[model samples]
Target: MNWSSAEIGVLAHAVSRAPSVHDTKPWSLEPRGDVVELFERFDVSLPRHDPTGRDRVISCGAALANLELAVRALGWDAQTALFPQPGRGDLVAQVRASGRAAVTELTSARYSAIFRRHSHREPFRLRRVPVRRLRALTGAASEPGVQARLIDPRTETAPLADLLEYAAEVLKDDRAYQRELTAWLSLPPGAAERTSLPWAGLVRRGTRVPDRITFASRLAQEGLLVVLTPDDTRRDHLHAGAAAQRIWLDAVAGGLVASVVTQPLHLPEVRAGLIEQLGLAGYPQLILRVGYPAEAVPEPVKLPVVQEEAR
Candidate 1:
């Protein structure tokens, strides 16, 4: 089947629904003949939280996965090429329509979740996710090259909580870091409007701040998982993104909610520390907090897919 503008538009809309860090949709798409090429927009990088820009790429990778799945939902096989060239830093993935293919029931089910999944920051309900359901989430990470492990031990949990407390304290004390966070945080209720983080989504500053704000709260209430890769490379990061979206969509299928934490894992020292403290043997790409949310919000806004000619 030949690709058309309407099909490309639907695929683009599905891609925009993928989860991103701090609602930063760090990607762009260009329709090249019959293929949709995805590029990582580095300008959307959160310099403070992601200095290395690894999370930015991972977010884009997740977007690429969504694009691929969207293509499949349209009865087409998506041929994807990751980081096609060495010098082109922004290029993430190229998805071309190969031919007509049957979209599996699982894929169709997950497609619904693609647009339904949202990064929830509010507190979760008292209901604990079933162990089997949690395992299904782990299974979602069973891609070509990725590993997802749920952190359940008290010994591992304690230190992770400590590290998060320390990181939060440090961030609070560091003026520059605070300024950067403030810039991202949304304005107060009924206050002046600004281009910042959505205040409604943020944990309030007072004692009422949700547990998601503090690692301890996350540890106590939610089911936490550590996303890891055997090797620390660009390809591994991309794989992690694929694994993350898979898990996210799986959670949606199971009526679960998830939120990702990269702030603590941003620092190399913190990453290593968490590994040592948790006695884990691989590089931690993201810390996923999952559970049934108490409240659900609308999907985050995303930039429209803009097609541009190759330079």
Candidate 2:
């Protein structure tokens, strides 16, 4: 492996910037001799929102994808093994660095997108994504066991909007869930504590997560894609995350912004509603929205992205 100590540190920063559930970063990185091992820090996971640890593993998978891209951009061939250690659920994946190669345009574009990609929550400009790009996105979203399905708002806006709004109300009224969510926004990842400030309008709250109808209206006008699997096991969620990360990076590479909608789907009602509305065969793991970003992407909170070290 051609990775140096400094390069490993840079790689850690890249992986750290990977989006987590509610920006909680429910994972940790340990730089071994040649490969960096990713572990789920279960303490930081959201118990009420993600009781099954699906989102936690998915968060690590996204980091795994970002780390692999950064490694390739640095001219190394990265080999990854999910759950390399048997029976160790915390060990999400192990990425081994070996050999060396020159960076290609594809790799360069993806690596660059790792920095530009953010889970944008605002409305996208009402524009149809190109057919070629949509095909490319679906291809990007495909991994070993995961598949992507596109939902056209024009064809199914009624149920989509209604379900979204209903899920929002259900989630907002759940005081326990709201309290857990508020805790994350209050302290964030590393902060000691917030100064008792109001969190209603401050946090991103992801795609009408706070019982707002306007966001639902905007969503019906935007492009939606569902990442699904035949079995909704923890392993499937991890793979789903890798696919989701690839989709987001592809969108960013094509000058589009994206975000994942999982909160509302956490409710069984929403999931059943989605299955009925879209007639999807498999378990819907995540809903990804991709479109034109707002004037400015929100600042990264607790994402330790190394601007200078990575380069």
Writing each residue's lDDT as its tens digit, candidate 1 over 1-311 gives: 34576777888788889877666889999988778889888788567767888888788878977898888877778898988878897887889888778878777767778877977655578786765667668988865658888887344666776776655545545666556666776656633222122211332222132233455545655677889998888788888988988888878766788877777676667778988878786889988778886766445323233343342
lDDT of 2: 0.73
Alpha-carbon runs more than 4 Å astray in model 2: 1-3, 186-217, 296-311
Residue pairs of candidate 1 with colliding backbone atoms: 184-197
- Report each candidate's C-alpha RMSD, comma-separated, in the order given: 5.7, 6.0
Candidate 2 per-residue lDDT over residues 167-200, each given as its tens digit: 6666656778867877776544522222111111
For model 1, what is the alpha-carbon lDDT of residue 158? Answer: 65
TM-score of each: 0.84, 0.83
- Candidate 1 ranges beyond 4 A from true positions: 187-218, 295-311
lDDT scores in order: 0.72, 0.73
